[model samples]
Target: MDWNCKNYHTLDFELKKYFGEKAIKLSINGGFTCPNRDGSINTCGCIFCSEKGSGDFAGNVDNSINNQINEQIKFLSNKWKSNTYIAYFQSFTNTYDSVINLEKKYTQALNCPNIKGLAIATRPDCINENIAKLLSSYNDRTYLWVELGLQTIHKNSSDFIRRGYDLDVFNNAISMLKKYNIRVVVHLILGLPNESNHDILESVQYVCTKGIWGIKLHLLHVLKNTDLANYYYENNMKLYTQEEYINLVCDCIEIMPQDVVIHRLTGDGKRSELIAPEWSLHKLKVLSAIDIELRKRNSYQGLKFNQEQK
Candidate 1:
């Protein structure tokens, strides 16, 4: 797909077309905690998740939703000249609480000026019929999409990561979300412990067959204060080099369906906390490398897509 002249379909490219301009994501913390971290399921969250639940960039939870939105808008104004935003519930499990409380936080964001849409990120286990219906209602009114952190589909890798859910759970979550016509975005992390390139590609293929609206391919980062960091040092773990990651990202893009929006190929971790994959700190260079590699091979996203599986 020639999205904004890029090789793959991008969320930013699609949003630009929909909004007729740039519509940035305003990451907000909803003061929610994952079931895995609240002692209900397991006290230690997913092995790789950070102290902030992988949302180091999210707004402060102490502030009201509106205040957080306003503050972020003011802070972002200096960099982006956009007037619209998508309220992104990024911290922890956004849908873990009571439905009533969830609506309050979501409504508060939507009520704010220039909030063009909503994006909620949570684990598959947090979703149910009630949550699905709630999200569907918002989808009918405004731009909305739910992101499920199904980091890997393989049982061994999932267990090692302490994800606390199974493939069946993720399947059910997708079914419920799709039943209500709500768009779904699935997250997958590459370079997990003991996973091979083939294993990562299999997970990519598995997600593509689900007909999800979007996908986020994350480069695994071992950040400080997390179990993964300890594992890295003690075991002398091998993280992907910049070239290896760039090539692997391009490999993933080749199998992805043309219509599936790529929300992220890679992202930066909190600088001070990141322990491995130091090359990831140069985000722009990594991104450029992916594009350049794709061009060199005269290939683009979906060039090797096997649509029959879907």
Candidate 2:
């Protein structure tokens, strides 16, 4: 059962190392929106984003953090019976709001029962000194992780995707977060329209050199009601199939630093919102297929990679 590579760190095992037990990330919609999509930058968002701003499957915002935690606890406990949970503020730029608002939402989740820590996903440009200071303070009491969406290092690709930020923002955020000892997780989307496979792999290598603690891989997805959908309809977009994606994912993993946690290897497509590359709707099947192929090949993360070899 060595999937893709022997040196790779699976996300489950990585969590156990920090939590001392099984830990679940309770995905919460903290009622946040990205500045890029909020008319500040005058962009609709990344072309692949859905109308709900990628939080469509996130927990209902009508409930308070405590209520959301309590509800999820019941469902997860009865189903998986896990005792530890991490309040994951997923969807949109979680740190884009003011410090007071950030404190209110995060404190509510932190006070919830069974929650052992917090994880906030946001854009690199949205991170501020106040956000970093507030988040770093929690390290003394609980695990704190900030997940940044650094989709690519290439400026041309970033501009084409309208990510609304630059690589310098990511570098600065990572540096400041590390100075305070807060764990950093980077989200790198593979298969942007014009990037070659080598371009994607180069980004992974760059992130590793930046001292990231974890990484998540997502195959480029074209969802309904997105600018990407327009491109698809116009025959201007290219997407990766399950087989193509799995191979590239394995290759990326093989080149990743041995200790960087692999948070995800596939994207969970929102069925109602997805438009093209329909195979993504079957995420489990794709992941399992990746695992099977990796084992058969006796390959592992970092197996074919060496920085000097690059």
> TM-score per candidate, in order?
0.99, 0.94
lDDT of 2 by residue, 95-151 (tens): 989999998999899998888889999988888788889888787788788899888
Q: Write the per-residue lDDT of candidate 1 for residues 1-310, one digit (tens) a residue.
A: 4587788899999899899999999999999999999998899999999999989999999999999999999999999999889999999999999999999999999999999999999999999999889998899999999999998989999999999989999999999999998889999999998999999999999999998999999999999999998899999998988888888999999998898999999965978888878888888888888989999999998999987978
Give lDDT: candidate 1, residue 123: 92
TM-score of 2: 0.94
Q: Mark the regions of model 2 whose C-alpha exceeds 4 Å error after superposition.
A: 1-7, 307-310
Among all windows of 10 consecutive residues in model 2, the one with the lowest summed lDDT is 1-10
TM-score winner: 1
Considering only N, C-alpha and C atoms within 3 Å, which residue pairs clash in candidate 1? none
